[model samples]
Target: MLSQTTNAATQKISPDLPLTAKQAQLVQHILAFTARHLTTAGPAVFALYGDAGTGKSVVLAHLFNQIQVAARTQDASPFAHTENYFLVNHPEILKVYREIAGEHPHLLKKDFQRPTSLINQMAKDTVHPDVLVIDEAHLLLSQADHYNNFYGDNQLQSLLTTAKVIIVVFDETQVLRMKSFWTEARLEKLIAPYPHETYRLTHQFRMQASDKLVRWINDFTHQHLHPLPTDVGANYDLRVFDDAEQMRQAVVRRNQEVGLSRIVSTSGYPSTLDGGKHYITEGEFHLPWDQYNYTSTPWAELPQTINEVGSIYTCQGFDLNYVGIILGPPVSLDEHDHLAIHLDRYTDVEAFKKRADLTDPTELVHIKQQLILNSINVLMKRGVKGLYLYAHDARLRHYLQQRAL
Candidate 1:
């Protein structure tokens, strides 16, 4: 039964999904809007945005599955009046959907690429489905930039042109690649025409109330964001450790003993030799950002992705349960007293050459510190329940604490 306060078309939340109260409310609105749009005729679209690990994808997945199941039911159900197709970025999801569809091959078509083809097939094959749901919509923007013809025009633009009803899931803050197509300006343009139809997912479902990392990030970005708790949202729990090993151990302890899901591990090295050790280590040090798909694995010798490893470059646009940040040595503050550090250089001659011309070592230090700080801010927010920090150096930990205050 729909609540008297909310839209009547909203779907009731099922018990299986562990959604927060606020998230459940939003899901209700999304489903309601979706049902309304499916029967309205012309194109309709919905947008959902939130912090990392906030269960945005999970809710969308549940709703998509629910829609498909609802469509299968008789004329008594709300969804029997409309047809639905769920499109998502993760290839794993497609496999799951295929399994769900089973031998009734006519209801679902696998290996289909074109949106037009998918929508057309759904119309011809189904009684009333015209709704399409796509997750990781930000990635679509990036893909559209590179392969514009694949989707033709931007992906969002194409969706508006094709689908009778569309739902998009994205977060503007998590744009990792510099070449992403969806900018604040572009999103503004897209939404200016439709004010009442747009919605936002604000409540954090994953991180604990103590997670203050996101507060600092939004402060920097000038975006007004808050976790569930009002006070913890003001400060960051910046823990300092002596080295990477110690940080890893602390993370393991947090997971095993404290029972936390998300922790961050960060490590930094100087890019150029200035007042510190400059040459690359002759020993077996794992290079950051290995090209061939950096999958998570535990380092028996050291703390790797034993949990989940998200580097400064790759961690953008993604969130995990727990994050362990390995703060590599050579981390320092710039003359301006902001975060700074040295970074490892991949085999990019031009980038390396640019690094060599640091007349003012202070600028390089500040840049490094800010980059790592940016990564840390993003990583810490990924945890909805809690944030644990293991700083390699006590002095640095003290500095972090002081700065966070």
Candidate 2:
């Protein structure tokens, strides 16, 4: 079945989305390298790596389309093997990509794949692409997927074996759960024997983040005790709201003017789908993530999503014009004036629960602390135009408000 990647007027996955000089350079580097691989027929792989909001997907879109155009015009093109494919593991992200790509459904679902799936498919069809440009490669699993029922121990290794040239866009920090098979160490092992090159992107093209803003974010997220910097610039539209309602109202106003905007939170419990609504909060700040049976829903791009809320899972790879964040009960500032995360209150118990149980009591706390804080940090940088924060903890909210002014 053919799938369109995106229909968003502003958030559409096209080459037109903002790209910094560094991001553009990375795209060119990958294209040139990919062309080189085709000429030599070398067994090669490349890791196009970056942090959240670093324009990794934007670059992926541009790179994928460039190859698509070249493949269609291969008689006059520069590379020997013009065949290529793009793979995605997350369905929410796949939805946005489908919306963006429109009739160009070069997407492969990782969940439906297993050890024999790719091999069997390739055996059945000889024209399956010599190159695969995979996005969200970090989400590829180590074991067989539930749906496929077929067993594949290492998905990355399978891809490396299947394709002549593989380009994976990976972010280490965005690994949401235990099932993901990619990590710095595993990445090293997977590409060590293959002819692989690495390219890095640092500038936050999505938020127009300055060095000070980036540094400030890193510092505060590492230690809530690290005093929040008051020097965050006006261009970013970073703010701390006392009430979630006010922040949401601001998001509503922005969505009217801007095409993409939404409220996301640190909470990880799947959205509550009852009576055709997905609710995620209780009390006065009643908010909902997009309605869903699961990740297959395109919550961010829908018109009705204005009323629905989003969590890290649904909104991670997608961009929005304005982002409203709910700190929920998991985060706050303590008496010693440090940012603290309470594991008990955090809704995402599935994140590091097993790891926490494995480590000793002391090490467990630190692991959860870092994972929870990192998740929040990733959410903060999702906006392209602005970031708005609503903290559930009074002290933390007050501290952030002061930093905002």
Candidate 3:
């Protein structure tokens, strides 16, 4: 296993803050090993896996910047390779890169025109740059294989084959999109060759001093976390308000009471289920991904907010200091009167399959369940301090708390 170090204070140009010591150690190992390999020969496949708000991007930024610095300081050749590329800075790049790739067949190869060239175009024109980093990797493997507007390739393979030195950052918990290559089975297949180098960022730094948040997640996973007691809690400090107005008012009050940040989420609109009372929701919903009146609200843009109240997709590619997740109503946990009461975490495999719409009902559902378990395990472990959960369904809440106990 790779050594672990916290980088909660590493410098960053992006909105991402410093990583924790555990995160820093993982980043150090990857950069150190990657630098050594690039300086020598051959290739390597590396992955930085963690939960949301665990600072994966900060580490990636650190590595990329360091590589640039190393190249300049050491006076090494300008990291040459090929051309025609698609960077994952934003989810939209998936489409932009594809449109650009069609006319340039050379770009399709691994490295997206790196390492190997069709007719050595770079040799004719100019040398292409080497090494590539893809962030928001979980989005690559979304279920919506093709967005209504475009087609996407196996994002992981594209990165692996194209670049001699490829770095992928992803969190299974945030797998709210279509399918790509981040699933457990695909990950197993991809990493089978290099079993020893896999690195997982398990410690969290996004919550408060208490373990309330972490304990809440443990309700589904049958796991346990002992966070230091602080402001946030699963009991009295956290409650399910009547609606958005009350929630926001309480958030404001809490900010004043604790002298800390505060955020609020709506109960969310329901997706009526085929004329049934039970609604079918698309996980949590929120702005940008799901528009609302308050786009620029201070609480909406609060520094520590997770923004997962309405949509999980909104929280992708970013971490939070403290996530105030509001439990929305119209949640559909029963698929023909069946719910995974045993699930102690949000990403439970059985629960995930039960919620997903798959073709082969049983088979797809089974796979989805495993995927959900993987995701929940990752998401629950994200908060370093705590996890606070409030389910409108008293039974679900009771079940969750019992599992936690």
Candidate 4:
């Protein structure tokens, strides 16, 4: 069984839960920022920047809960009687937030919505919320996505027009889709006109790995593969398997020992949204991609998801006790002994959808490669207690095994 602190279903925003000193201080700062700008003319932006597993979501959850509680219950509070909404683009994450909402009186499930849904609904109602908190703001569509029912040029710009104060948690590395692509420069340019404050959380609150190991993962994600740290698995369970099946077996053992362990992969293999099982087959390892989750429960929390290989879609922003990562065909080692990303081997077509504003061929290739590497980075950082790895490319696999010794 998963511990209370590590369990996804329970480790959510709660009014009674205590925050870390740093998290509390940041929440207070945001509260003060919202109060100072509530009566201002334009939208005020409070941008919280952090990497995955830096307790970013928890901070948002706590901050939003405080906002709602003050608005609904505390008459003397500056946020009293203000309308607010919490938005996230990913469906799986939105589900988790909505489920968290159900347990609290001030938090309503309706208050938590997809970014596109909230934008369209607010426009239709001709109402502007006083406060809007966005989790996974990187997932917001940077361009108009008609298929997702967001016709606005930029979701953030649209939300800025519809809200008095907007609080967003962003991480550039977690940007997965072309439609939702974001960078520090682009984000800074967009918010230049607004009254905004930015804060970056640097602490690694999710992974139990040492700083050296964390640096190793960061270096690997940036196309630099160095030898593993000498004490790689001393404090955290780190392993590189030559065989994919063996890695899966190790992950299974970890799951049986401690819940919330699962295998995840980067973009490769046959994957599509056709409502059929797309198997990821290695030499002796075979498992289907994570099916579309119909229930409100987060995908990683489901007991049966242990049998499925989670992709970026289902696993982002969630924690696991142990993660077995399959560095797919897109990931390999080049002649210079550096990690190389092959765009052709990347099977997630949605991630590479063309954007009209981005037309330079060289720039497009760079962005695609970066996004692929970003997915690997996200998967690698999912494991709170341990991380296991297997590469599809023979040379890359050999390189990792030799370096991990």
Candidate 5:
């Protein structure tokens, strides 16, 4: 049901596709609006705002196919010459969509680019489309000079000016990097002057488990360890393990039988500098991040990466049959019997050490805490079928065991 690319209009992308009944109703409204926008002339905007696994991408994918087919066939499309493009910031995500839409040639190489790169090109490309879709807007970098020498005043404004009817698929909490700039407040301010429609996806089509899992994950994300959850619901299996090797083998076994199963974890594990070949060695398990960088590496889709691990960046915006996670050092159980975050233990916060001389101690701690929590939340929600975890902290493992009852 979930074909990477829709073969035909009749091939509905999974009946359980991440869309809720209410979201579906809003999509009808968007369809009606698109028809009107195609015939009329006015600046139009729509925001697909939802948290992780809420089916935002599924909705965008369906609309993209409908619009492209309509424009190509000149049957349902309103404009005689319709120009459109689907923009994605991550290479791994782009690869998945390209494979799904194999040889469709609807999305070009230039279409999938970092927000900075695309904005720089947008300043030069004269053919602004009538419709445009931006997937994963959270990854749009705010700092222009550092990433790509992007001298644009604002990436969001440039994108808004690039198309008449534009759609942005965004998740505010998914902003893992310090550079990305798309938050709900900023989006609200940016699209304030335009005629716009906002649709939120509430139903999570990713996990077939109880809605409690979602709430529990969110609670865990914010470091609330109370009322430890039990039972991963009627249809899900979430287990906590102490042995990293055992967790890795289980993920490998699952991947061999069904596709899209892989190991992902927080950046707490150290990467050995044996000539830039990062092998995370802890006890019996020695793992490496995907052979390719998480930004571009399609680890889940590639067979070679069956043993390699993925980070929050690589697995975000995608779903898997199963997920094996290593909670690592950033998360732990405190003496007070609550989930605690250790900024020093997480390798990601090592960068903050350099800024310690200049940055406030309190603010620095807050930033690391937030980033660690965000990454964990994203990784936890990746599995569609089941979620497996191996917490480096013994106490945290026990806590997870209680939660997975």
Candidate 6:
């Protein structure tokens, strides 16, 4: 029997699910922090930092559930009768969280909301939540985005002023847009004046790949392309294809066998927000970009999405059984055998929007390049069991194919 890839058990967040030892310990620490800062002066911030698939979201889900349970059930609990909300900026991720809330009695659907919605609602109602948990905090807008209806200078700063306690999960490598651009220094500077605690989660929980393989991916995304390890695919399925068509065929077969396998690409082909389909064509392999998902189900979970090419917007913060990644035109290998990012070839206009706060030409170029690489990093790590690769540039394709052998 073929396994279901996007079932509720796999994608939904459950508070009752058991955590690893380190995760459990972190939950205890967060509870203690909340207790100590509940009655203290200013807002208290607890920042959880981790890479993609480091189980940061799971920690936040479990911690939030515990807080809500205590607040509603135990009169003597420190969080008794306290109002709290869980916020995420991604619509797809917010859908998953809201669906999970329906399964649990303590977690209400209204408790999970987008950051902008929560901010606007709290201001309109003139109410302050006792605690606010933000998932994918890196996606929060740092600058005013009138298109998103966020008129505030910064989402995090606005939330800090409205909530007594705030918990945020952040991964700097996953920052993909200029408007939400952030670094450790920027984040630290913002919360320096407030009472805060920061914790870093380093364990790898999503991918079954070996440590050496993980290191190779890290090196590649950092602009260095080294030869693959001898044991690269011993524990995980890793391959590089000379033809994009062949890679797509492999992804289809994997999806039929194990399900949840889909092809994704970087931003170099034609794409827009005009509500029309734009295709990503590579030789004989062609597919439209992922369509706007209008249902409550996530794009990856929908059966029809397999025929489309997934992007960072739809696939980020989600896992797959196997992933076929087409390294788009913007990614190439330089004469020095290093990965090069071509900004001119990138087609994702929203990701490259000019930020008024940033004007240095050199810094602007560097930030754009990093964001391009960051998108690749996000796509490369989506597979839980396997990863396939294809490149649009001939030199990079040959390099990867030769290294695979």
Q: Which stretches of candidate 6 lie over 4 Å from their true place?
A: 1-3, 6-12
Write one digit per residue (lDDT tens) for candidate 6, span 45-69.
9999999888998999999999999
Of 1 and 6, the candidate ahead on TM-score is 6
Greater-TM-score candidate between 2 and 6: 6
Name the candidate that leads on TM-score.
6
Tell me, by lDDT, which candidate is best: 6
Alpha-carbon lDDT, every model: 0.48, 0.69, 0.42, 0.88, 0.70, 0.89
Angstrom error of the Cα, residue 94, model 6: value is 0.7
Model 3, TM vs. native: 0.58
TM-score for predicted model 1 compared with the true structure: 0.62
**Each candidate: how many clashes?**
43, 14, 50, 0, 2, 0
Between prediction 1 and prediction 2, the one with superior lDDT is 2
lDDT of 3 by residue, 1-405 (tens): 001111121222222346667766776787666655564444466777776555666676555545544554545534333232324634222332333333343334232321123113333544343456666666553332332222334445534543456677766555542243255456657656642256676554454434555454544433222322344443324343333444444444543433222332222334322443322233242222233323222222333332224233333343222334444342223433233422232321222422243467666644544444344444333333323444445544444445443
Q: Model 4, 1-405: lDDT tens per residue?
A: 544324464464444567889889999999999999999898999999998888888888889998999999999988999999999888888887887888789999988888888888888985568999999999999999889998989999999887999999999988888999999889999999999999999999889898888888888878877898867555589998988999999998888888889999988899988999999999999999999999878888888888999999988888888999999998888888878788998899899999999999999999988899889889999998999999999889888788786
Give the runs in model 3 whose Cα sits over 4 Å from its true position.
1-25, 39-43, 77-129, 142-144, 148-152, 193-196, 209-215, 218-237, 240-245, 254-289, 292-310, 320-322, 329-360, 367-390, 397-405
lDDT for model 1, please.
0.48
- What residue runs in model 4 are displaced by over 4 Å at the alpha carbon? 1-7, 12-16
Clashes of 5: 2
The TM-score, computed over Cα atoms with residue i paired to residue i, of candidate 4 is 0.97
State the lDDT of candidate 5 residue by residue for 1-405, as single tens digits. 223412221122322245566766766677677767765566688888888887777777767766766676765447435777777777667766655465454534444445555566667785566787778877765544443476655566777776778788888778775555346888888889888888777777778767877898888888777654565678887777778899888888887776678899888776543446576765899977765545333656666666788887578877777899988887888888888888768775323333212267686677667767888888988888888888888898887677555
Cα lDDT for residue 365, candidate 5: 72
- Name the lDDT value of residue 216 in candidate 3: 45
Greater lDDT among 5 and 6 belongs to 6
Model 6 lDDT-worst window of ten:
1-10
Q: Least lDDT summed over 10 consecutive residues: which range in candidate 2?
A: 1-10
